[model samples]
Target: MEHKNTPIYNAHSYHTKVPPQGIAPCILHYTDPGDLILDPFCGSGMTGVAALMCAHPPAEALHLVHDARLGPRYAILNDLSPAATHIT
Candidate 1:
């Protein structure tokens, strides 16, 4: 992908159909190898995967706030939606 041509904006993967290709360039430009990056939503962990592929170790953390009964900040949020999680 052309780094300069692609638009940089906050958008969800489901709506834009643009897989997280933009992540690689962003990481390459601003961060060094082994630098930590966080993707709070991490729909499919694509940003983390890209970081790994680029030789940067990534620590992925997902925060799911949809279930009010479970309350926020619950780690179970990560486990509840396996289908929505992909780590490459």
Candidate 2:
């Protein structure tokens, strides 16, 4: 069977964090195989996850402003508070 798009779910505990399902497609479409995505106010790092999925490997392929607060680590992520950063 063919797989559909990524499902949207509560991936993180944030008030207004975009889901990876929604952001991934945009990231892949807009950027090439190797590009740098910087989400300065990366709330939940959904963008980072999206970036990672697009490149899919070797960590060095793609880059995201992936702060430790966020799940991925390719770019520098920043948040207003530890809670926000932590959640991302």
Candidate 3:
């Protein structure tokens, strides 16, 4: 069965939710096997997952930045806070 093309913003399936389904063909078009793709923001880890699904090894570098006030203000508080630790 063929998967229907849906807007990336609206779909909830893993293929749609994680990676913009429309971009799969684009990825295949531009990238060869094992190429490294980078998504700096990496919100929800979608791009990495998308690269893996396309038979790429997944993006090699990921930098996650969380808001500071949401968690910790100093070294000690950061170490103790789960949100801060997640950032680390």
* Best-performing candidate as measured by lDDT: 2
lDDT of 2: 0.56
Please give the range of 10 consecutive residues that has the lowest summed lDDT in model 2: 64-73
Residue 16 lDDT (model 2): 66
CA RMSD of each candidate after superposition: 13.7, 9.1, 15.2
Query: Which runs of model 3 end up more than 4 angstroms from their true locations?
Result: 1-20, 56-88
* True lDDT of residue 14, candidate 3: 32
Q: State, as a TM-score between 0 and 1, how close model 2 is to the true structure.
A: 0.60
| lDDT (10s digit) by residue, model 1, range 1-88 | 3332333323223332233445555555555555667655655555654565454321221121121121111111122345555422
Pairs in steric clash, model 2:
64-75, 65-75, 66-75, 67-77, 69-88, 70-88
Task: For residue 44, give model 1's deviation from the true position in Å.
Answer: 1.5
TM-scores vs. true structure, each candidate = 0.45, 0.60, 0.39
Whole-model lDDT values for every prediction: 0.40, 0.56, 0.37
Collision pairs in model 1: none
Per-residue alpha-carbon lDDT of candidate 3 for residues 1-70, written as tens digits (9 for 90 to 100): 2224534333433332344333444444555565666554444343443455454222321111121111
